[model samples]
Target chain A: MTEEIIIAGFGGQGVLSMGKILAYSGIMQDQEVSWMPSYGPEMRGGTANVTVILSDERISSPYLKIVDTAIILNQQSMDKFEESVKPGGVLIYDPNGITAHPTRTDIKIYQIEGTKLASEMGNKKIFNMIILGGYLKVKPVVKLENVIEGLKKSISERYHNLIPLNVEAITMGMNNIVPYKIEKHVFQN
Target chain B: MSELKLMKGNEALAEAAIRAGVDGYFGYPITPQTEIIEYLMTERPELRTGMVVLQAESEIAAINMVYGAASTGKKAMTSSSSPGISLKLEGISYLAGAELPAVIVNVVRGGPGLGTIQPSQADYFQSVKGGGHGDYKLYVLAPASVQEMADFVEDAFDIAFKYLAPVLILSDGLIGQMMEKVILKPQKPRMTNEELIEKNGSWATTGKKGRERNIITSLDLQSEKMEARVHRLMKKYEQMEKEDLRFEKINCDDAEYLIVAYGSSARISQKAVELARAKGIKLGLLRPITLFPFPKQALFELADQVKGILSVELNAGQMVEDVRLSVEFKVPVEHFGRTGGIIHTPEEILEALEQKIIKNGSIRHHKTRKSSIL
Candidate 1:
């Protein structure tokens, strides 16, 4: 299956990190994957986004205009990507930050309180994992176990203590998700 | 035998150059490409190979140093960004005129001037179309990843020596900065003065012996000899075009549309292929591993099969000209790119393909076929 995902938010919102974690997990599962980030001046306070493509065949490009799924962590990201998601694509957003709702009825969306849930778990940094966890629950693209392994390998030696909380946040986020179906739009040939 | 380790494109190139037995590295500091000299400095690979590593005062001086080292029959290399490379063009043209063997790595950044320190493939025309003056061509290798970045060094050096011409490794900041697993080969030194003399001691300037005084010069006072020299260079270039054309093709046999791109742009175009496939469009990618010996024949062969061609690049439309030249206005050649350090996303490329290739499929068949002759 072709899974084109974009993880976007402010610089410190862990958008790029979440994209990397997912890409790393895809690599571990032996899936052809590519992780490309938005660079140049746009990377400063601007929205940082990464397009992660995981497929069974070789990935040619890591860029995407219309993503199959988008994980938006802030209002800016939601506003930026609302029109770009495919007609039947899924959007997972942080309800506390993403104030704008999508206009399309065919698309599936999950409004997650990732920051609040991670804060309740006693850490603000685990918010990305919480979002990732919500993403995992719906897509089930990569195994949760593989993602955990990928996270352990990615974290630095100085921040190894944060691993447990992040994993806990992921499990918490996954458990809180409610499944919904996306209507498939048919295009006439 | 060697082991694979994670390496950035710039670092891998440095390591590979050392293994290929480069005589010296003369370069100035530039973003993205800085890691190349840094790798040589940190790893001290030069010390192991008895190679000289000099961080020059400027890109101009570094290229001049390359010219000098190459003149001595030493395998020298230099690297810089787009602006920095622009500074070195005069020196590069001189090296080309002198028929010297050197490797110049342009870790491209956006430009015309002091552009941002971000990855870009905008120097396509400057690289392939004689960046400086005079009718000359430098063998250019466009690598798409860290692996090819390393692998191309040996081939680049070999081609340079074989043709007695300068070679360029055209990569962008992403290839320089991004990390990936790479395999390191054992060091293989280029032919020595003694070896060269033994092979063709009569021609090289290993201090002329009891024989006639030896002079190595690109200039000849006699116009007839100068014209002959030009013809010889042209003959060499033609031979190179025939022998050294390298490219990577995806499912082009059944492809309705083809994406023609090189280096980092090619990698991004690969993603566009899948996006198109999912949308039920039969697309393929033609990635050029060698930029200069433009694979005219390959694209010409596919002209009848593929409906249209998408020339994806980091610049506005540098390689687009070459694509047009190859196809000869046969297929509808459209361009999709980002400039001034703005990298084109896969989605943008997909949109362009949708508009130009998929929607305009009929246009490809309606257009007159370009000539196959080179």
Candidate 2:
């Protein structure tokens, strides 16, 4: 199976690192993966995004016009990437700063209050991990063990003590995701 | 041997150079390629392997430093993006004229000037056709993957030392910035000064001990002497073209149309080839690994079998001229490209192939076969 995922958020939201962790997890599973970030001066305090592709076979073209999944964290990203998700695909968003909700009915939508939960947990840095956990809850593309191993590889040795907290945050996110169902009557008329 | 690790192309290149026993690295920071020097500095190769890494004040100074190190019979390298590479042309020409063995990497960005930091192959003509003055050719290797970005460092150094000429690793920001898994080679120690003196003593200046004073200069005032030197250089280039031509052919056995590209463009066109083939159109890809000693002879032979050829690139149109020259006008050769760091999608490339090359009906049998496939 192949999953083309786009993760977009503000610069300080760890969007690029989240995609990198997922790519490392794919490697742990002996799968081919590529991580390409939108790099430049604009990445500082601006909208940062990354495209990560995990496939059983060799991946071609790291850049894609359409993605199977979009992990959006901000309203700008929600508005920009809503139409780019493939039909019948999945879209996960954190209802933290998103003012405009996704309106696409053909795709599946889920919301996790990752920022609020992370604030409640007393550590705001684990926000991306929570969002990632929400994604894996709906579609378990990779095992939790591999993600833990991925965190070990991606994070530095000095930060090893924080893994348990990050793991707890991930579990909380997985348990708290709310499926956003669209009413049929809205489009029926 | 080291275990596989996920790394960016720039980082892998720096690590491979250190592992390949390079004596020194001198470079100035440039966009999309600054990671190479950053990795080197962070690793502190000087402490581990006695390898010297220096950040020069400018690209010109960096290349001159490479020239000085290479003159001492040491393996040295430098890397830069397009605008910085332009500043290095004069030193590069001097290196070629002096027949120095060194490696240079161009992580190409969009430019005729300081255009953009995005990836581009617009330097194809400038790189392969001799960017500097005079008639000299650099052994140009184009890497499409991060694995090759790591592996080609050793290969480029080997070829540079074997031929005693400068070699270039031609890549773009796409390959420079993207991350992938790479299996790194085992560490090798740098050569000692005595080894350099013994191996390259015939031409190298190693204190002129126990021999006539050896001189290294590209200047020859006599007309006939310069003419003979040019002829010798031409002969070496001819030999390299014959023995060092490298390319890859995919699904070409039964292909009716061929796509020619290199580096990142090759990776994109590979997807387009797969898409076209899935729709029952017989399309194939020809990727040239060495852009200088280009796979011209192979393209000439393949031109006889394919009905048409389309050249795709990130530049406006540079390598297409080489492709057309290779085919010698026997087949319908067309060009499609995007410039100024804009990359073309696979669907757009497929559409271009269908509209410009396939639907032109220049090949009599292809029109009927196309109808059956569609």
Candidate 3:
């Protein structure tokens, strides 16, 4: 099976690292993977996005125009990628700071209050892991164990002690994601 | 032993250089290729393999440093984007003239000058057609994946040393910046001074202890001697065409149309091939691994089999000229691409193939295809 995923958010939101973790998790599972980032000066506090493709066969293109899933975390990304998600695909987003929520009925939508959830968890840095967790809950594309292993590879040795906390955050993400019948567009923030 | 690792193309190239036993790496930072030097510095190959990694004052300084290291029969390399590469071209010409062995990587960005930091293949002409002003050709390799980005370091160094000439890894920022799972080889030991003597004693400045001092220079004032040198360079290029030329053919056996691209464009066209085939169109891809010793002969051979050829690049239309020349204009070879770092999508490629190759191949074919589409 092939899963072409696009992760987009603000630069500080760990969008790239989230894609990296997902890609590494794919590798851990013996899947072929590629990660291509939309990079530039725009990566500095501006909107950033990365396309991560995981496939059983050789992946042809790293960056894709259409994708199976779009994990959007901001309004700019929602505006850009909501239409690009393949019909009957999945879109997961953090409801925080998003003024315009996804409106694509053809694709499934899920929401997680990643920023508020991470704040509740007492670590805002794990916001991306929360989004990732929410995504995994919806699709189960990769396993929790592999994502933990993938995290070990992406984060430095000094952060090894933080894995349990990150894992907790991920579990929180997975547990809290709700399917989008919540016409409640913005976050409860 | 080899191990699988997720790595960006630039970082993989750096790690591969260390694993390849590259003696020294001199470079100036530039996007999106700064990761090469960043990885080198952070990984500290100097501590790991006794390799020297230095950030020179400028691109020119870095290339000249590579020149110095290479002239002494050391495996040396430098990497930069388009503008920085242009800065190094004069030194590159000098390296070619001096017949030094070194690996230069151009992680090209969009440019006629100071262009965008986004990826581009616009440097195709600058690379394969000899960017440096001289009667010389760099042994050029284009890598479509991170694996090849890592593997070609050793291969480029080998070719450079084998021919006592500069070799270039012509990568764009797309391949340089993208990450993929790559199987990395273990570190090999560096060539000992004795081995260097054995391999390059004829000309390398390896301290003339047992033999006469060898002088390395690209300048010989006599016109006939310079002519002979040019002829010798030509012979090396011809030899490269015959021996070192490399390419990959995907689904070409029964293909009615061909997409000829290299590096990232080839990777994109591979998907285009799949898209076209699913739609009942017979399309294939021809990926040139070596841009200088291009897949000219292969394209010429495919010309007889395919109805038309689409030369897809990330530039305006540089390599299409080479493609046309390769097929000798016998087939309708058209160019399709985007410039200023906008990567063409696979669907765009399929559309271009239908509109430019299948439809434009002939008026009758165009009408038939148009009716089918409608």
The candidate that achieves the highest DockQ relative to the unseen native structure: 3
Q: Estimate each model's TM-score.
A: 0.80, 0.95, 0.96
Per-residue alpha-carbon lDDT of candidate 3 for residues B12-48, written as tens digits (9 for 90 to 100): 9999999999999999999999999999999988788
> How far does residue B6 in candidate 1 sit from its true spot (Å)?
5.7
How would you encode candidate 3's per-residue C-alpha lDDT over A23-111 as one tens digit per residue?
A: 99998899999999988787557999999999999999886788999999899999999987999999988888888777767888888
Off by over 4 Å in 2: A183-189, B361-374
Q: Which structure is stronger by DockQ: 1 or 3?
A: 3
TM-score, structure 1 vs. true: 0.80
Error of 1 at B338 (Å): 4.5
lDDT of 1 by residue, B1-374 (tens): 67564456888899998888888899999887898998898878656878889999999999999988777677889999998999999998888777888899999998878878887888888999999988888889999877888999989988998898899999998777655546688778656768866744454466676777555566677989878878877887898899998999987878988999898898888877877888888999998888889999999888878878999998888898889889887788888888877778777888998887778757554543333231
Instruction: Give the interface RMSD of candidate 3.
Output: 0.7
Provide i-RMS per model in Å: 3.1, 1.0, 0.7
TM-score of model 3 vs. true structure: 0.96
Off by over 4 Å in 3: A182-189, B364-374
DockQ for each model: 0.33, 0.73, 0.78
User: lDDT tens string, model 2, B245-339?
Assistant: 78999889998999999999998899899889999999999999999898888899998999889999998889999999998877888899888
